[model samples]
Each structure stands twice: as structure tokens, then as C-alpha cells.
Target: MLNVRLSIGISKILLSAYCVLGAAYTYAQSQRVVVTGFTGTSSRVPQEVDAAGSEPVNALPSWEAKAWKGETIHNQVLLQGGTQQQQVSVTAGDLADGKGNRIPQQDLSIGWVKYVWTDEFRDGCGYRKSVDFDSSLVADRIQTGTNTMLIAAGKAQPVWVSVRVNANAVPGDYTGSIIVDNGKKITLPVKVTVLDRVLPPPSQWHYALDLWQHPAAIARVHQLPVWSEAHYKVMRPYYEMLARAGQKTITASITDEPWGHQTYDNYPSLIKWTKKKNGKWSFDYSLFDKYIAFVMDCGINQRINCYSMVPWKIAFRYHDEKLQRDTVFTGAIGTPAYNEFWSVMLRDFTRHLKKKNWFDRTAIAMDERPMEAMQSVIALLKTIDPAWKISLAGAWHPQIEKDITDYCIASEARFPDSVLIRRKAEGKNSTWYTCCSEKFPNGFTFSPPDEHVWMGWYTAATGMDGYLRWAFNSWTARPDEDSRFVTWPAGDTYQVYPGPNTSIRFEKMIEGIQDYEKIETLRKTYKATGDQVALNKLEAALNNIRISNFNQQSATEQLAPYRSLLND
Candidate 1:
């Protein structure tokens, strides 16, 4: 009996030792590096290892995305020209082995996602608490130039991978892998299934994207003098980026501080106005010509939207050659002074634009002005040159609807079917714009990333020509660092960053625009083939996409079915 008892005790001790060894082995394995993939439309905020709870390994699942040829798709990975984006999250455990030896950081193929201070405006719009509210650092800009990232122990890092499927890529399943080298190779597999249909390139797409540009913002952010050679050199990549997204309008301010200094960087006039000593007005088109030519060279040659015959403050500035100083003309719309002020400049400007062959493409643009004021401006523009094209981003007024060539109404308003049809027939463009006034489906930093892409689909469903946004790069003081503003919600001022870096919001918006192009292409092909069945089905899917549905469903959820149908 004593021998049997001693044997039982030895067996129990051995069993307990084995269990302890097994747990240690398992924990050591878990302590190693981990990589997971997520969709580009979804943004993953980095969480501290401690705050991520006891299990951070299972935070996300694998990544997969579908796209059409020539479509730009966003995941953590991106594909353009048949592009898709895929985002990969890398989490490090203790960064040491069970033996306590340190492990090397990984090499990311694309770049790391940078965190920027962002405020959660939730569903509110226009002027809210900037502090003492729900605010945190959100991962946004993808560090384009860097190819490696160092993740601290117990923290995670996100990497953005963009893959461009050639425009002529065959329709089939394609597989690729993102390799993370951390001494030992960690492979993250990427799978993409390209649909049979083709999406036209941005230049050919019918969707007219008009994201207003603020060149001064770019100059300020880069610490370069406005319009300097260095400024132009730096501005090239930025404009080229805009061109890639199918931007249709060139935003030019004819008057100083066009919008009453609403942006962080005041918009200096592109065209210099000079009043001569002999009481005659002369215009200098040197800067205007150079900027417009530069933008056209960058591939955004569609339309030039010159800001305001009526500026927000009803004030105009000119170089008084007589006084050898700058002068401001404060004249209300339709007044004698206002009429005289614009008439001389318009006549000379018209002649100069005609000389450059830019008159036909140029529009005297206005934003959110009253109907009465717009009518007065339109009348004045016609008086200067009946052939003048006009553009307005404001409430739709039927009284002056026929006069504006590029009419972008507020998202809250819609153009009547008859009016839209007439404008389409007249070769005029009608679109919609969203700003701080809107809460849901905006490009605010706190807003869901999917909303940016949703705007493209909404434009397609509503039968609008395209979409317009006020500020493409109206960047705040430190846009790359923080996205908050005193006047509006976070990210309201800009979309892209200083490194000329692209944001998840911006990339996802491009994805949505590509979707829009795909929809348009499919519609045209089906109609030409007399495929009424396909047309009806497509229309049905689009009809279900309503702004009202935003609350009940996510943009991804709404897009999934239509994407599946397209893939089929």
C-alpha cells in the first residue's frame, strides 16, 4: 500500500509539470508577431495592448475584395486602373522570445498608417465642442514614402497596400502576398476576383467630380511662397493626384479672399487687378494664365470655375497704380459702383481669356449666395459678355437655373426632372455638393470612412451629373497631425495630406467614384445591346439606394448586393 501511494504521487506530479510546460509553450507562441488584413473602407483604430483586453490576436479576420477591370477598389489593399486597396494590421506581442531575445521590426511593402488627432462629432453638424468631447487619435494618412514600420511591444500598426490591376487584366481570380520580414518571413495572402465588366478610366467617366482646390493651402503647408517655382514643382503631384480622381473643375479665385477668408489659407486672387493713374482699369493675367496652364498640364482640363462676380463680403481688391498701394472696392451687387467695378475688369478679362482660348471653358462661379444676388450677378455677367458661362454651388433657383452652365445644388436640395433633362440636353452639367451643414454621409474625420464612397453611389442613383466638394486640400494648420478646425468638424478643411499623402477617406472616395464609373459603363453597354432586363435590374438596385436608408444600413451593406450582382 505504501509503494502504490508513492507511485500515484509521482504520476500526479509528472502530469502537473506537463500541463505547465504546455501552457508556457502556447503563451510563447502567442507572444510572437501577428498580421491581419482589413478592408480599405473600414478604418481600424490602433489600440494599446493593455487596453485591447486580454486577447488582441483575434481582433480582425483575413482580407478579401472584389473589383471590376479599371475600377479602383479599396481594402487595406488598393487597386487602381483596376485598382484595389487592402489595409494590413500588424500587432507585436512582447517583441521577445521565451528566451528573452528581442525580435526585429517588420518591413512593410507599402507604408504605415499615421494617427492624427480627431474629434468625434457623432451626428452633429456645424460648430460643436472641439474639446471635452469624444476625441482621440485616428489612423488616417498612409505614409507614402516610408517602406517600413516599427510597432512597439503590445501595440499594433496598420500598413496600406495598393495594387493596380492593369486595365487589360483578364477577368479571373488573382492571388498575391504581402511579405513582412521580421527575421522570419510572415506572409499575408491577398485574394482578388476581378469582375467581367470594365470600368472606364476617370477621364472617360461621365461622372463630373468637382472638389474645389485651395492652392494657397498647399503653399502654406509646404512653407513655399505662393506661385514660386518651388511651389509649382511641389504642386504638380497634388494636382496630378486630383486629376486621377476625375476632378472636372479648376477652382480659381478672381477676387481676393473669395469666400470672406473662410479657410485657414486665404485665397489670393489669381488675376491681378490694377487701376491706372488715368482712371482706367487694366488686368494682369500672368498668374492666372500660368496656374490654369499648369493645372491643364496636370490633366484636369475639363472646366475652369472662376470664383464670384459677387464675392461673399461684396468687396474687391485691386492694385491702385495711382496710389501705389492696394485698394478695396466695397460695392453691393447691382449697385452702380459694383457694375462699374466688374464691367471694366470683365471686358479686359474676357478679351484676355479669348486670346488664351479659355473663355468658353471659364465660368463665373459663386457659392451659397442668395437668389437675388445671383440673379444680379448673372445679369451683369451677360451684359459684359453674353457668351459667359456661369457656375453656382448653392440652392437651386428655377428663375435663374437656365443661366448657370455648371449648377451644383446643396445635397439637401434636388433639381427637378424636367430641369435636369433640359440641362442635360443643353450640354450643361448639374451636380450636388455637401458641406458642414450635413451630418451623415459627409467626409468629416469622425464620420465613417464608407460615407466618402457612398457619395459616388448616391450621385449615380440620383441621376446627377457628378458630385462636388468644397475643399479638396483646404488643409488646416497641421492637417497631417490633427484634423480639427474651429469653424467645422474634423477633416472638414482637407482630404489629402502634406506628404501629398492620401487618406483612407480620400482613397475610399476614389473607390466610390470608380464604382460610379462602373455603373455608368454597364448601363451604356446594356442599353446599346437592348438588354432591357439588365437595365431594369440595375435601375432597381440603384432605386433602393436612398439617403433615408443610411440610418438603417451601412454603406458597405448597401453596396454589397450591387457589387455581387456586378461580379455575377
Candidate 2:
């Protein structure tokens, strides 16, 4: 039997009652009957009704999906068939399942899109990705829904991301492609030049360098767009050696005292005071002075992290020993004892110089103590002079880790954009995380946001970071000694593999030169005017350029001697 119910409106019945009654009798009597009816969402509008009328009695699932606006009209009808080779037709408001019953078509359109995809990645792997864009310059009425509507195919496809635009847009032609995969990308080109308004520049880019990066990172940096690759031959020696020693230093060791003594506690004045007072620490700059001289002579930017305020003997216990009473940090660097000591120490460190009147230029900043100790140091330094750039370094864990990250981000906005973490693959009976940097045979863990923790290069490329720390130099070239380096005086020998010397000087040099130039440019352009926005943009651009695979930090060292000219 065929039952069709058609109501045109609240008061009108449009379905042919006579035709349906006769069809029901025929359907009940037929043998090979073909029953067909339309099934889809109905809209209460004259135009949508017309479109529904245009649809065929039977259509494919793919062609039957579309949306129309008007009013609510859930159409329903049914065609029952009992005959073979016999056919019955109906409109979209009708449906039937052999038993002459109407069925809902709601289950047909499954998993439809609700928003358009905006391309954001560049063509390749590491380095190039996010393109600089002003979120306020969108030109079109953006739409988001379960349908994907694109006017073009292949390369002509739109690649631009969208942000709701406002009236004050300084418009002009804006265009670019986001890399999707190798040789595949979507592009959106727009021309919206406004009258009498200046559009932001497409981008401002710069190179970056960190004087203490793995040489592999340095050699790789040379491939970025910002690196002056043509002039990178000067860093050739620095990088080539590292590249040749491509193997990683899988073992990492940290001694209680990397320098074998308190930073400035060995000077004549410090020694005299300590000797007379029976102190555990003294103030001295003999080694510091020599280190500064060596860097100046090497003509390389000096980046270093000072380990501790208290002597290793007094601060961290040796092999889990108790803190000795006689220590450098007997609350002597602070008040009642002397306030000038800490401030004077930094002041003198910054001001100490050779005949050229140039003190050692340092960028590495960190204090490894708890937040309270760090805060005291910061406060004292700020009072004595607020110009010194100080960064706190400590275990990136628990509450203290968050404190460190928060302070760095808010105080200096210096989060590293890229982090390289060496994670060991999981295997049966293997219970350890293996990275190329260090070996913790006894099992060591790093608190995150520590420069050494891996976060990939994405965060760095987008101005969320300013430094990356993965420092390990293969000391196996010292051959007979433990390749797992512990630096000097004492050594930690937990090692996995043996290899040639792994010096990352090349990478460090590259980072240093690039960053120096970048900061210098910012100072030149915005220092006098105090353009924070411009400065932020400059920093962002530099960060992006730093992550680009094409960056040329390998050529960094050779140009350092001439950077002063560029600064001028």
C-alpha cells in the first residue's frame, strides 16, 4: 500500500488523495514493485520548496546534501511496493521501506564539516612555518559551517588565515601561501589598499645566536633565511669541525662546582677577609678576569651560567652529604653583614675591563637557588642598579619551576622558542629516557622549561621563546679519559657510546652573532623612540627567522669582528 501525506500549509492539503488511494491498491497487488521517494530536511520557504521540487524522485547520497533557509516544514510521505519490475515515484518530502512506511533521512548525512580549514603551516619540516600577519586586516565576510566551499582547486586555493576585521584597517594587497606538505600549499591573495592609511610592513626579520648552543644547532642555523650565508665562511672552521663530529654526546654530567671554586671568593681582599675571619668563601676575580680576557682574545660573544653563590663545599652536599657549617653563603652577602657585597660584586663584574675599556660581554643569566634566594638577589641588584639582565636558573619542577618560568616570561619575556629533547624509544626491559645530550645512568630527571628540556622549535619561532639550551661536548677526543664529560677538576663517567670530540662552538657562535645583530637593530630603531609595538614585532620576526631551516649561523663567527661596523 502507498500512503502519501502532503500538507502545503496549515490549512491546505496538496497531496493527491485520489491518486494515493488508487496507488495503495495497486502497490498491494503488484509483485516486482520499485518504490522511490525523496528524503531530506524541509524548509518552509517558497524558494526552498521550488528547489526541493527540482530534485529528482531518486538521487545519490552525495548529491542529496545541501542546506536552505526559510521556515520549518518536515515533509513526510510513503510508497509501498509488492510487484516486480514496477516503479513508483515521489518528491523529496516522501519516503518508504517496502512496508509502505515513511522513514527519516537524518541518519544519511554523517560526519559533515562545521568550519572551514585555514592553512597555517609552511611547505617543509623544521624552521619555516608561521607567517607574520596582522589579525585585524581580514577583508572578507568569513563563514564557518558544516560545508567546505572553495572556489578554486590546486595551487589557486585560498591559503590565508582569517580574523574578524574592523574599520580602522590600513588596507593594501596582502598575499601568501601556507606550507601544507612538500610542494603542497593553499594560498590566499587579497588586495585591499585603503586611502590615506599606512599598512604594516609585511615583516621584519633578523638572525639570532646564543653563544652556548650545540655546534650542530649552529651549523643548522646557517640554513635559515636570516643568516648571511655568503659571509658564513668565517664560521666555517667553527662549524665544519662540529659537523664532522656528527655523533652526539649521549652522556651529560654536572659537577657540584663546575669552576672548582666560588666565582669571586679567591681574590686578595676576599682571601684576606676569609683568612682573618675563618670563612669558607671569599671574593676574588682572578679566574673570572682570565676568562674574560680569553673571550675577548677569542673575539667571541661570552655566554655563561654561574652555578652558585655558596661554595660547593658549603651549599650542595657532596654525594648527599650535609651542608658544612663553614660555607661561602653563611648569610654574609646580605645586610647586617654587608649590603654592598652583592651589588658591588655584579657592578665590578660588569665594569671590569681591559685597556679597551670593554668589560666581558655576557648574556647567560641564572641563579640556581630557591625562589627566595633568587628574589633577594634580584631585589638587591635592582636597588644597586636595575640595568643588569638577570635570569634565574633552577630545577624546572614543582612550584619553583612555575615561578621561574613566570618570572622569566613576565620580567624578561625570554622563553626559548625551540627545545630539543632526546627521548629514548621504548623497548622491552629498557627502563630509561635516552637523549643525545646526557647520560644519567643513575637515572636523572630534568624539570621542564629548563633550557635543556625539549619543547621543539615551534614555540621559539612564534616569539614565545628566546633561548634553547642543550649543551654537551663530546670529550671522547680526550680518548683515555671518560667521554661522558664532567668538564674539569672532577668528572662523571656515566657513558653509553664513545665518539670524537663534540664541540658546539660553531652553533654557539652563530647564535651569538645573529642575536647580537638583532638586539642591536632593535636598539637602533626603537631605543630613542620607545616603540614597544615595533620592538615586539622586531623580536617576533627575529624569533621566526631563528627557527627557519635556512638560517645561516654557521657563518656567524667570521662576521663578529665586523659587527661593530654594522652596529654603526
Candidate 3:
């Protein structure tokens, strides 16, 4: 009887312990990290509850996206050739056991989405103002650096998953998985379908994407001396990124603060000017040659645009050897001082460029100057060398249209059919540019992400050769943290971040450029095959891509049917 009682007691104790252990295991299993996928176009705020006072929802179990061979597809599963990105949100459910003990967070080994503070403005255009606007933290920056993400209980973290599809990738379906280890391994499957069509490599692209560069900003952001070896090293990745986007023109400054110190960083002259004791001017082209070679080597060999026969301030800087001091020449346009000042430089520059075999590809570039000033500058350039090229990005002036070799007018401006035809026939390049002036169809951070992509299609539809913007990396004081400036809307001064990080704006813009390339390629192919039906279909689709359509329809909606037509 005693042995029986002891056996029953032991069995009861064992059963009770078993039940407790099982319950603990079940509770632990319930506290899993939930992973959800979202479209790249949708900017999700980093909050546990949304503005609707409810938790955000996604039906996807794992992240999946599709794209073409050379396009960069965003989180929306839109297709592209270059890369496919999926925005994922990882949320930690009750991170503790039933005992209410704190559970350690897991280290997420993937790319993170950085939230930047942005404001809601009346229009996407114009300079910065003190007007009251709704402000919030926006997810824009995609940091690819290896950083561990830890999520607290009931909180979520945004992850950026990008997969690059090579230019020569075979058109088919591809599959991968993102494994998140939070004590237990949770595998998220990723699916990508590469469309049959191919996007040409950036080098083969004809789009003249001229995003004016600011090397000085790179140096400042990296805390290195301007033009230092380390600075160049840091700048290499940035320029290479531009090259990958099919950049055509090399922005070279010939005078200090060429835009009259409009940007945060001063635009220093690449060619050093010095007035000798004998009163003759000479230029040191070492920096100019190095920079041009550097950019050309990076595959931007189309045109070396030396800035300003007409700077905004009209103040030229040169070292006065006799006084052993730096001097500034305030010579107004058309003045003898101005004419003589540029005449010597132009003559010497022409000789130097010819010797380097770069004269044919170099342009005396100007930006947003008066028509009279442009006429005088063009006359001076022509007087020096009839073969000298002149590039201008400003209001359209028909009088100087013939003289401008690479003319980029404002986005609101249009060249007459005759002018476009004549310019094309004469082998001249015509493009369009957008600044803080244009509200819709601009690249401001507050602007819709699709608007950037829309600009590319608009270029093709409007029969423009390429696109131009005033600033590429003219970074603000804290570019990675804040994109706001006193002169322009947030993110107006820079397209990218300091870590050489790319933003949603930059990536989408590149996608549009790729679209432009694909369109050009398909147009030529259709022409070669004499497929008027397909050509007409493509043309009709482009015709519908007007700014009016853009306002009424989302870029995805506007581009979908047309993109499918191209794919077919």
C-alpha cells in the first residue's frame, strides 16, 4: 500500500511539471516576430499604430517583387531590369513569456529604412518658406550598410531588401528567401519574375542625364579636405552611382562660387587662374585635367561642361602674382573687362582642350542668365572659335537657339517642332530641366515618388533628348538627417545621402531613365522591323502620358498599360 501511494504521488508530480513546461513552450512560440511586405512607393511611418488608430496590415507572408532585366523595381512588385526592392516591416508581438519577463530582441542582419522629417506644402515647387505645413517623419533613406535592427515589443522596424538583376539576366522567374533569426529561424520567401524585355546598359543609353554634381559637398560630408585622396575615394562611389544612371555631362566650374554662392558649398574653380607679374594671365589646368579624366574614366565621357562664361555674380577670381594675393574681377556682362577677361581664358582653354583631344567634346556651359548676356557670351565664344561648343540651361530664347550646342530649357518650356527638327538635323542636343520653380512633376522629397519616374516618360513623350537638374549632391548641413534648405524645398539640394546612400527619389528617377532607354530601344526595334502597328501603339501610349494624365492618374496606373504594351 505504501509503494502504491509513493508511485501515484510521483506520477502526479511528473504530470504537473509536464503541463507547466508545455504551456511555457506554447507561450514562447506565440511571441514570434511578424514580417510583412509593402510597396516601395508607400512611405510607412515608424509607429506602432497608424494615424487611423489601428495597426497596419499586409497580407503577404513574405516579400515578393518583379521587374525587367535592367530596371530597378520598387517595393510595389513593379518590374525593372537593374534591381528589385521590397519594403518589409518586422513587428515583435508580446516579446515576453507568460511570466511577463523581458525577452531580448533579435539582431536583424539586413538593410534598414531611415525616416526623414518632411513637411506637407501647398505645392511641390518654390523656395523654402516659414508657412505652417503638416510635418511628419517619412521613410526615404535606404541604408545598405550592415546594421542590426532590434525591435521592442509591439514595435516594428522597416527593412529594405534589394536584389540586383544583371543587365544580361535571362528573362524568367527567380526565387530567394530572407531568413530572420530571433532565437528561432523565420524564413521569408522572396520571388522575382524578370520580364522578357531587356533594358540597355547605362553606358549604351542615349539619355543625357545631367544632374549637376557638387564634389565639395562630398568632401564636407565625409569630413575630408576638398580634393584630397580620401575625398576622391569617398566621391568615387557617388560619381559611379551617377555614371550607372547614364550621366552625360561633367559639371566643371571655371570660377569660384559660379552660381554666386547659391549652394551651401562654394563651387571652386577647377582651372586655377593667375595674373603674372608681367600682366599676362595664365591658367593651371592640373585640377581641370585630373577632374575631367576622373569623370571620363568613370564612363561620363559625353561632354565636359565648363561652367559660366556668365556666372550669376559676375565676379571672377584669380591670383595676382604681383601683389601675391587673391583678387576678384567684378566685370559685368558685355563690359570690356568681362570680354577681355574671358577672351584670354577662352583662347588658352581652347588650345589646352585641343591638345588633350577634348575640344570636340567640351562646352562652355552657362545657366539661367539673361538673353542679352547669353547673346554676348555666345558671340564671344564664336568669335574665339566657330567650333567651340556652348551649352545652356535656362529660359528658351529662339534667337540664340542656333548658337547653343547643348540647350536645356525649363520643363515648362517647349521647342517648336521646326526647332527640334532643325536642331536634331544639325546634330545638336536638346533637353529639359526642372528646378524649385516647377511644382508638379518635380523631384522634391514631398513630391510623389512616381512623379520622378513620370519625368522620364514625359521626356520621351515630349520628344526631349534628356533631362537636367541643378543639384545632385549639393548637400545641406546634415544631408542624411535633414534635407531642408533656406532656398529650396526639402531634398531639393541633393538626391542622395552622405553614406553615398541612395533615396527613393534617386532610385525612382533612375527607374524612369531606364524606362526612357527601354522606350528608345523598342522604338528603334519597331522601326527596324517595320512594325508600324507596334510603333503606333507605343506612340499613342506616350501621347497619353501628358502632365494632365499624370495629375489624374498614379504613375503606376499611367505606366502599367503602356509598360505592358512594351513588354508584349
Using TM-score, give the best candidate's number: 1
Between prediction 2 and prediction 3, which has the larger TM-score? 3
TM-score of each: 0.87, 0.30, 0.86
lDDT of each: 0.77, 0.27, 0.76
The best candidate in terms of lDDT: 1
Q: Candidate 2: lDDT of 72? A: 10
Q: How do the residues 1-568 of candidate 2 rate in per-residue lDDT, one tens digit apiece?
A: 1233333342243246666878886755444322122222111011112233543333111111111111011111212223233222211121222344322232111111111111221111122211331111111111222222322111111111211112243333222211122112222122111222121211112222122222222223344321244323434444333222221111111113422432211111111112123423333455344433433333333233343342223332221113333334334434544445444445555554333344222322443345555555556656744544443433332333322321222211223323212111110010112122232111111111111111112233333323222232221223222221222111111111112121112222222323333355444668678877766755554444321222332222223233232122
Residues 1-568 of candidate 3: C-alpha lDDT, one tens digit per residue: 9999999999999999999999987766446444444445544434443345654544456555556676655452111111122222323221222343321223112456676766654665555653556666666777775634545445445665555565666666665455655555566655566677777788888888999999998888788999888987888889898998899989999888889998888789998999999999999999989988998888888898888778888788999999999999987899898899889999999999999999999998999999999899888988899999999999999999999999999987898989988888898999998888777778777777778888889999888899999988998887777777777767788888888888878878987887788888889999999999999999999999877775577777777777666556
Model 3 TM-score on a 0 to 1 scale: 0.86
Candidate 1 TM-score over all chains jointly? 0.87
The reply for model 1, stretches above 4 Å from the true place, is 1-31, 46-63, 77-109, 122-129
**Model 1: per-residue Cα lDDT over 347-402, one tens digit each:** 98899999999999999999998888888888988898899999999987889999
Cα lDDT of candidate 3 equals: 0.76
